[model samples]
Target: MAAAPGLAPDAPLHIVSNAGSGSKDAHEARQQIEAILTAAHRPHEFILIDNPGELARVAKQAAEAAVRSDGAVVVAGGDGTINAVVQAVLPTERPFGIIPQGTFNYSSRAHGIPLDTREAANALLTARPKPVQVGMVNDRAFLVNASLGLYPELLQDREAYKRQYGRRRTVAMWAGLKTLLREHRQLIVEVEHEQGSETLFTPSIFVGNNALQLEQVGLEEAEDVKRHRLAAVIVEPVSTTELVWLGIRGMLGRLGDDERIRDFPFRSMTVRLLSSGKKRTIKVAVDGEIFWCEQPLTFHVAEHPLSLLTPTTVK
Candidate 1:
């Protein structure tokens, strides 16, 4: 197997595998990845991590090792795991790769990384390094998207529901519906962007770094990811019936036609909560991980682009 451009064939590859990812058999996934690397005659080291808290520490160590040896780090897990590793790898400017084993591999898919474990591993041999822009919320980096209001609430409830029941689409949908019906309070926020400043009364706000995912949800597709901009979709304040209708449209992939759903592009923005005496901190879901960040929250493109190894066919 040929190595990617600028990457030496003899250079070692460091792999961090999350054993608790959405994959049915993490052990099998790790074995398959190792087999592919071995067959290619690549020097590699693999580590399996089950706890999320330890991911940052392990990945940081791997990244440091990679820097000294001029190697790369491969993360085999879901978006959340990838996001965690990204936080550590971005600062080091090390070459990064991913094997999508998540329930929603939005980040990987957006970058054209193969979802199949074997295919993804094979692609790595010939993939090329590309600089992809990343989105930042406060101090953290998110590869896919982040949101507030009803969406965040829904995500929180979905995890609780999943814990009681099981990880299922039906359960997630039910949780979202329940959250929407129960949490009817609207948020009044002041949004300041490159365009201008505007006050909005909304129930939800979605900020996306991946245009393909946004397009799938009926928002306009971004012409370029390297533009270092975010695509935002804000749900305008509406009656519960209208909100339900908007949800139906989103589910049916017709949200683009819904007037209540506003879409725009921004290089940077500030979202300030107008509710008096509201908590200084609020929950923001970044790549499916919940984080409580101090408001007024700021969103912007990162200063440096991620050095990603993607399939040659992706470009």
Candidate 2:
């Protein structure tokens, strides 16, 4: 824990909003948020993001403006959208807020923020900034989780599927099944963690920083998260049928007892690419966005906890 960032009673809000990131009607959500702020006589500005490429720049601008104006930077989008803003604001020490607009909003749900964007907007008015831990990978901040290997590929495929079949959870699930059944490459990596180091043949290595998410996925590692340690799940190589059955077990809250997967807890971990040999570049999915990062990648708790604006004291 750290000192809380003080908020002024009438501080202005610099909100970085992506108008089309989630399934909700952004226009109506924005209007309702504006109405709340207007009724409360709070001055605010929404920095609308026009495209995905503009997210980083928009977040930087909002964070800088909030710092200069003694206000706070608020993000109205999904986990990936908020991750960009967190990266920008963390270095500047600007107070940050979130109006949840995505499915399974891990960060917001973990902090006890309202799931409805409009309700979260109203809560933002009286919220106070609290220091909260965030997971960091190769200098990028992820509030919930960061992963590599087959999981990243699944996310990439899911995005492509979303563009083709529409944005729905069922569509994402179908995409995952398609990716799983298709021929996949194994990830050979040298993992250096607290316990020891080993070259594990696995399809995906998932590192979770949020207890709620890990628990929902039926992983006992969620308890590790509660103990202030990062939880990791490594999916060992298995037949396609077994893999599908494993996924079903996960959905049914039986993954914790499955022998096909190995779970561990660590304060920090380093991963080096072994399969690619000379090529160190790999696709990593942080939150829900995918990007290329040159290995070796270090996963650890950030040096400084983010100044998150929550409706109540964060657990």
Candidate 3:
């Protein structure tokens, strides 16, 4: 991949850290990051964000500052924070760096960024900027998967359940069960992609930009992330008992064997709600965060490539 032109070796760096990520205390993480940058003789500015709600604002400001100075922005947080930062920086020519501090760190992991903060920082110092494809739903950019129906509802319920009970597998499973029982509604949708159009009466639809993560769940087989296409999977509606069984199969990482799951790839896709009223809208989850988008929802590869600072060892 070709590198972006503006991010030179001596350009200044700006780092945005989310306070509530991972198991490490916010202060401790900041201290460690500062120490690593200092030891590397890299001059940088650090912005510590205490509230989740302020992340987008703070990141956008940092990205604007970085663009003005011909610098780069290093995001030190999980997927949600990274997603916000990516959106903020995508408009600029500035290169983006990542230090994974989230539970899954799917974006960083897919790009081969080291999970350890110190090591990730080292990779940042040594890595080169490479242009990578980004996926867009409506106008917002997402580096991971975007989905509607059961998955989004499950994500909403899981967060609420996690707050009340805890972040355990059992709690998550219970949350899934509760959500499915309460909010399991079928979607009657018309999907138009590069291949053709199809009418589907399914309970869920998932479109993936990070195909590796989809493969991890046995939903896809493609390993390439720079393909510049979206991988989509639709789950055929089934009885509640069968749905629970399917969920269990997903948990056991055997979803690929399930006959009801259909997978395909597309350069662009449009999903329209068949039962929609005059003003059509639906709640869709982009990289695990939920938002309402107007239908027919349009998805495609972003117009510009995202400049990413990734380890040279990562191919």
Candidate 4:
């Protein structure tokens, strides 16, 4: 087999460490990355980020450094970190890489980036930069998925519970149940897409870009992603108990068949909050990171694709 045309053996790698997470896992990832590249005699440097709040700024700096050094921009962390770095790297048109330290690792796994630390680092040596589609929400990159309403609320609620109860799997499950049992206000919106338009009253709007994540949830719309389109899912307004049951069904990977849920595929969409009253922005969870985005959130495939350093086996 012909060898993949990758970066020069001595090309610099500007690695952003802990830009998304400050957990011990990130620190260990840093250590492993350093060890692998050092053994291979590769040129690299780590932009160690001690403060998670500086993720966006640090990511920009890392990307700029890679551009100046004529190297690749690499990130070590979960979806959040990758999302941050992706936003920076996209404009530079630089080779982007990731070491999957995140739990789900949807984006990395989707592109054949290994989950194992050493293997992921070693693969970076020979992987070629491949143009990959990316989804953008209000001009911000979301490598995996973007969500609004109950999903972000559930994540916030779970974080609160983790502080009070514990961080065990059981605690997390209980927290999700507790969050679902409560009443959630529906989002009344005017959704416009390629298929046409409609007004929807739902607890959450989930737009998926990664096929692997969509498949894991048993949603057939995963196929939509392969066509360079985004997949959307919304649950009809329902009672709290019924909503809780729907959440359970989702966890069981059987939620797609339920009548309460509706999903479709589209190239682009404009969502206007018709019932938001005076609110100018809403909390949106993009690639597992939460932030407030202005009204009329637009979701679509980015005009330009990301140059991802993907393993040749994947191509």
- In lDDT terms, which candidate is top? 2
Cα TM-score of candidate 3:
0.91
Q: Which stretches of candidate 3 lie over 4 Å from their true place?
A: 1-3, 19-24, 165-174, 181-183, 221-226
Query: How high is the lDDT of residue 81 in model 2?
Result: 86
lDDT, each prediction: 0.83, 0.86, 0.82, 0.85
lDDT of 1 by residue, 235-258 (tens): 988887787777767777788878
Local accuracy of candidate 2 as per-residue lDDT tens digits, 167-215 = 7778888888888786667888899998898998988888999888888
User: Which run of 10 residues does model 3 get worst, by summed lDDT?
Assistant: 219-228
TM-score (all chains, Cα) for each model: 0.91, 0.94, 0.91, 0.92
Model 2 residue 256 CA deviation in Å:
1.5
Tell me which residue pairs clash in candidate 4.
none
- lDDT digits (tens) for residues 1-315 of candidate 3: 345654666777899986655455556777888998888888799876877888888988889989888889999877777888899999886899998877678889888899888889888887888787788999989998889888898998988998899666588788887776663778899999988998999999988898667777776545434566788888998888778887778777788778988887887899998866675689999987898998888988888878989998986
Of 1 and 4, the candidate ahead on lDDT is 4
Q: TM-score of model 1 relative to the true fold?
A: 0.91
The prediction achieving the highest TM-score against the true structure is 2
- Cα error of candidate 4 at position 115, Å: 1.4
